[model samples]
Target: METDIVGVSEHRFDGGLLAATRRFEAAADVTREVGAGSVGVAHTLIALARMPGGVAAGLFARQGIPPDVLAAGLPGGGAGQASDAGAPRLGRLPVTAGLRAAFDAAAATARVDERVLLIALLARLEAGAVDLLAGYGRVDLDAWLTEVKAGRRVGDVFGPDGAIDPAAFGPGASRVLAVTVTEAGALGHERYGIALLLHALATTPGGLLEQAYLFLRRDVRALREQTLTLAGSRPRAGRGPAPERAPVPDEPVRQVL
Candidate 1:
C-alpha cells in the first residue's frame, strides 16, 4: 500500500490511500457557512444564552467567566474590550443579552438560514469584521452568498445596481472553492492520488467537476479493465494502439455561482 500526505491551512494531515478528515472539515466549514453555523455561532450562542437576562460569566462559576462581559448599549462602550475585533458586533454589545439581541436581529434578517449567515460570517471571518448587523453588506461573497441564499434577493444582496465585479469577490471565496474541491475530489484515494492536482482541476470549473466525475467513473472502469487484463483478456486484433494525444481546445463556461 502507498502512503501520502495532505496539507491544509499551514500543515499536513497524512494517511494511506484516501485522506478524509481535513477535507471533511473544510467542506463542513463551507457547509456550515452555506447552511450551518455562521462564523459568529459561538458568539451568537453566547448572546442567545443571555436572553433570559443573566450574565454569561455566572453560569458556570467553576469555569470562571470574565466579569467584564456585562452588556453594553453599544459595542465597546463597556466590558467588550476583551472580545476580539473580528468578533461579530461582539464588542458592541456590552451585556450578553443585548449581544444576543443583535444576533437575533441578524438571524431575523438572515431568515434563520444558518448557512447563509455562516458563509457571510466566513467572509467576515476572512475579512476580520462583523458589522453584519447594519444595512450595506460585508461587501464580499461570504456576505453576499449568505444573504442571497438565505432569502435576501440577489439584487438586494448585490445592492441596487447590478454588477459582477472581481473586486467584489473575496479571496476567501477562492479559498473556499479550492478547499471544497480538494476534499470532494482526490486527496489520497488508493485508486487515485488527489491532492493539489485535484484541487486545481476540479475547481478550474466548467465541466472540470464533470471531468473529475468522469475520472471517478473511469476508476470503476479501471478496476474492470485491470481485472480483465489480469484474466488474460486481450483487445481484438483489429483494434490498434490509441492515437497520439492531441491538445484540447479551450472554451469558457458560465461564471461560478
Candidate 2:
C-alpha cells in the first residue's frame, strides 16, 4: 500500500478523506505557484501551514513559522501567490515520489485526517526544506504532532453550564457529535440525551471513548443497541411525584354540560 500512491484514488471520499484531499490540492497549487515541477515536501508543508481551520496551521503558528514566513523562506518566494484565481490547478502537475509514499501510507492506515496527513508529511521531511524550517525555529515535530492528536480532551467539550457544545472538541469529538446530533434531530429531539452520547461513543471512530471500549473488550454493537433502547425510555426529569395542592372548599359541584 505504501508503494502505490494511485491506490488513494480508489478510496472513498468520505467527510474525513475529503478534507485530506483538499489539503493535497492546496499543496499542488503551491507547487505550481512556486514554479516547482512537482509537489515536494516543502510545498506540502506550506500548503498545510496555510490551510484555514487546520490543525497544521495552528501547530506551525505555535512554532513561530507562520504560513507567510514559511512560504517566503522556501524556494521561489511565492508567499501569498497560490491564492490567485488564475493559479494552475493541482491536476496540472505531478507529485513527488516521497509525497506519494506519504499519501499511500496515510491512506493505508484507513484513518485519514489533517493530523494523520501532517504526521505523514513531517515523517518524510527532506534536507532542503527541513533546513529552512529549522532555521526559522526549533520545530519540535513530535510535540506538535502530540498537540494535534490530543490537544482537546473529551472533558474539555463541556462548557461552564455543564453542557457539551459538541463543537468545542477536536475532530474526533466532532465526528462523534455529528452523528449524535443528526440522530437526535431526526428523532425530533431538541436536545441530545446521555443515551445518544453513548451511542455516538459506540459508533464514532478514533475517539477516546472508542479506545476505552477496546481496552475493556466490550461489545460496541451490543452497547449501541442498549443505548438505543434507553433512547425510547421516558426522561427522568418530570417523572417525580406530583406537586402538592391545597384542597378546594365545597362550592357548587355543578356540571353545566
Candidate 3:
C-alpha cells in the first residue's frame, strides 16, 4: 500500500471500527496540541496513554505510566517546564510516513482494533519516543505487545461467566451474535447451537473471531469442519415437531460499524 500523506479523518481502515477511528482522531488532537507539522506514531502513543477507557491506557497503567504521569513527562508539561501558550496551531496536518506505515501494518491484521493499532504504533516508534517512554520506567516493549495481543478475558462474552453479563457484549460482539441468531433461525433451528455459532463466526467478515484465527495462524475452514463434526455427534433432544424449511440469506453477515 502506498504511504501517502493523508488527513487523519480521511485515513481508511480495513474494518472501519469506531474505536480505531476515535484513536486516530485522538492522535490528530495530540498532533495539533504539540504543534507538530504532521501526526506521528509518538503522538498517537501519547494520545493512547492519555485517552481513558481503552486497551492502551490500561496497558500503560499496568506499566506504571498512568495518563497524568505520561503527560507530565512529555514536552508540553511537567515540573519546571515553560507553558505552551504560544504554540502554533496548524490546520489539518497530514500524517507522517511512519504513522501511515503503522496504520498499514495494523490494517494487515485480520481485524483492526485499538490493540492491533497500539502494537503497530509501538513497533514503529521513533528513537526519541522510545527514550521518552523509557524515562517513565522499564518498558519491555515485546512483553507489553504480547499482553496486547493476548487480550484480557476478565469478562469475555463467549465464556460461561460472562454469558449473562449485559456489559460483556459490546457493539461489535452484539452484531456478530445478531447475525448468528438470524442464521440459526433461517436454518430452522429451535435454539442457538455451537455449530451455528461457529458458522456465524467463520462467515462474519472482519469480526474478532476471524482476527483471533489469523493471529493464531489457524484456518477458518478447520474451525468450520470441527464445528460440523461436533454438531453431528451430539444427539438431538427428545423428538419435537419438524421445523419448517427456510431459505438462508444469500449474503453473508457483515458488520457495518
Candidate 4:
C-alpha cells in the first residue's frame, strides 16, 4: 500500500498500525502549536491516502495483492496507462504499506474522496495551519532534527541554524533535514521527525488535551476536503475524461486478480 492505512503487512500489520498512529500523532503534535486554529490530523491522514495513486495502492493491498502486483492501478487492469486500483495514477507518489490501508478504508468506509486530501495538505500548509512546533531554548525542533540528522544527542547538535544542517546527514537522509521540519515531513523523516513533533507538542503552552484537539481539527479538515475530490473521481478514456465508474451510492465494480 502506498498511502497510510490500517491494513498493511498482516505479518507486521500490528506493528505498522502502532507506528503509523505514533507518527500521525507526532506530526499532529507539531501542528498543535499554531494558533488554536481549526486543523486536524484526520486531514493529514486522509490527504496522505488520497494522494493520486495513494488511494489505489491502499485498496489494492487491502484486497490482497503481492508487492509486485501493486504497480497496476487495478489488480487485473494489466500494465501501462491501464491501471488497476493499485497502480500510481501519475508521477511517483511515495506509498508505504501502512499508507495504503488508510486510503483503502477512506475509499471504502469514511466518505473521504481522496483529492481533497491533497487539497487539504496544500491549503493547510499554505495557510500555515501551525507554524514551527517550537523554537529553540533547551530542546527545540531544529535541535531535535539536528540531533537526529547528526546521529548524535540533542546537546551535541546545538549549533547555528538549529537542527543539524543537511550536511550532517548522509545523502539519503539529508534532504529531509533540509526541509526545516514541516508537519507533513514529520512522519516521512522516520523516528526523528515524529519524536521532534511529539516533544514540541508535549511541551506546548496549552495542556495536552487542547494540544491534541488542535491536531484533531486539522485532521478532520483534511479528511473533509478530500471528499470534495474523491467523490469526483472518474475513469478517463483518452482525449476527454470519462464519467466515474462508481458514484457515491454505487458499489465499485472491479475485477479480481
Q: Which predicted model would earn the best TM-score?
A: 2
In candidate 1, where is summed lDDT lowest over 10 consecutive residues? 9-18
Give the TM-scores of the predictions, in the order they appear: 0.22, 0.53, 0.49, 0.17
Give per-residue CA lDDT, model 2, range 89-196, as digits (tens): 355566666666666777766666556667778877656566676765688666665766565565444555444443333345456666776556545455556677
Q: lDDT value for candidate 2?
A: 0.57
lDDT of 4 by residue, 1-257 (tens): 34433232222222222233343443233223322122233224332332222332233233343323221222221111212345322122223222333344434433333332222232222111112112111213243324332343433333342334323222222222332243223223211333333333333234333346576774333432343233332233322322222111111111100
CA lDDT of each prediction against the hidden true structure: 0.29, 0.57, 0.55, 0.29
Task: Please report how far candidate 4 places residue 158 from its true position, in Å.
Answer: 33
lDDT of 3 by residue, 67-143 (tens): 54544455532111112333211235556666766767876776565677788987887665666677556788777
Question: Which tens-of-lDDT digit does each residue in 24-113 have in candidate 1?
Answer: 233223223333222233343223222221111123122333312312112332222223433332122222233333334444442322
The TM-score ranking, best first, is 2, 3, 1, 4
Error of 4 at 6 (Å): 13
